[model samples]
Target: MRKRLFILGLLLIGIFLFIWINNKWIVVSEYTINSSDMPAAFDGVRIVHLSDLQRTSFGKKQLPVLEKVAAAEPDAIFITGDLVDADRFKLEPVLTLLNGLSEISDVYFVTGNQEISKDRAEEVLSALKRTEITILENEKAKWNREGETVYIAGIHDPLMDISTYDPLIDVNFRNQEIEYSKRARDYTRESLEEVPFTDDFTFLLTHRPEMIEEYAETPADLVFAGHAHGGQIRIPGIGGLFAPGQGFFPELTEGVHEFGDIRLVITRGLGNSSFPLRINNRPEVTVVTLEHEEVTGLNK
Candidate 1:
């Protein structure tokens, strides 16, 4: 009996250690995006994609995250929102991270559902405006290199449409949830309509990855997004068990998914929101390298 109890205690300790490591350890996911539409001058440009911070601090002043991003030597950094959690609203951590990131490379941002769910979005935006970071809200920005240009566009999260934002709307009745998603999609379409997309390589930054269809309708060649925290937990072969917008067995939890001519890159994100624990899904910072594929007559 004594030996059995000792073994059980050891097993429990192992379980605890595993959970702690998964939550605290940060992983860097790398991907190479190749496209003939890419400008030759922009070839080999690196982009560090971060999302759904939810006010998580990795080391003092976000050193862990900053160090990882700096190591990537990114030409630009894109954040897809949830920088502050409405439940535990704090702007200092988010600012600290932004300051460090700014020193490394140009930073770009977009709103997430969490930003809209809380009334403090204005505060967040105000703080960001004080920095060099470009806040893209239903707008477009131009990225140039060697006189060649590409467009970067961003849209506000659909939750902004709600006069009284309720984070729990997803957990409500099935019909209501469906209606909310439909409305959100329409809002996304409307927002994109405001941004003009040229034939040049274009990148779209948004919070939710589940809105792939809305984004696909646009002329964006690439989309960087988050909001599904790797579905909170991952099963080896089964993938994410659940996600906020996608629900059980959510499809767009992480990785690059293609929709016709466009590709969507979903970062697992760095922090937790409603769910406090992450199982098997380690927090990650995504590094995407752009490669301008040379088109040949045979391929064409």
Candidate 2:
């Protein structure tokens, strides 16, 4: 009986670990947000979103994966932070892969925590500037799609204040906490950034996903964020169990969540951190289709 019990225990452990290594990706999460005020031509506007490259050498194989996203024929490509890891130094390969993507769609970018690492941020920025990419730091830019212009606002990685370069002495964000609230608001209010929010449909590209509640009340129609890496673990029904910010039993782990007037879409992110391992949650680059959520549909 004891031996049988032992075998059952082993089997359970095996299944438990299998859950950790489950594969949940199905060619990115496609969301269609319906908006009444959105332009008709921009009605089915498609966007491909990528985050947390960490400046790693993804090679030719990874390059093709990106083409898969482009193959979706997205109108725009949006990248949210963590482009490079810094200390190790070398974004050339990542840049090479991105450079080829120019043929895919209009590309826009925002910095991430890893990109701001003092070890190579300045250097990385210099190289990035040389590219045709738009580096949005507390700024905004507009793209004309079929006569109507759409605005995308991007903010620098607020988490870059600490971590990276110096080696992250405190993994615990204490008094050195990053302020995402005020800075995000300041960028919007001043119009010193991307598309102004009065009557147009706007999207905010951010690195950290923890501030959904904070940005929920802002003028943004859709906010895209990635940093949690889908808690790096997920259960069948419980969903992503770990994520940055919001603490312990964190509310936002990954995927989409609605907060009042704003809709927040958080990517599980591509790449691993803190741990060099990943199971079920594979790296992801999303192709999200924004369907105008009729102004009336919002209350639901």
lDDT of each: 0.90, 0.67
Model 2, range 106-204, lDDT digits (tens) per residue? 788888767766655677778888887888776668777778876788777654443332224557545334444455435434432333445476788
Q: Write the per-residue lDDT of candidate 1 for residues 64-92, one digit (tens) a residue.
A: 89989999999999999888888888888
Q: Which candidate is the best by lDDT?
A: 1
Candidate 1, residue 240: how far the Cα is off, in Å: 0.3
Residue 36 error, candidate 2, Å: 1.3
TM, every model: 0.94, 0.78
| Candidate 2 lDDT score at position 215 | 64
Q: After superposing candidate 1, which stretches have Cα over 4 Å from the reference?
A: 1-9, 167-172
lDDT at 231, model 2: 72
**Which segments of model 2 are wrong by more than 4 Å?**
1-26, 55-61, 160-197, 247-249, 293-300
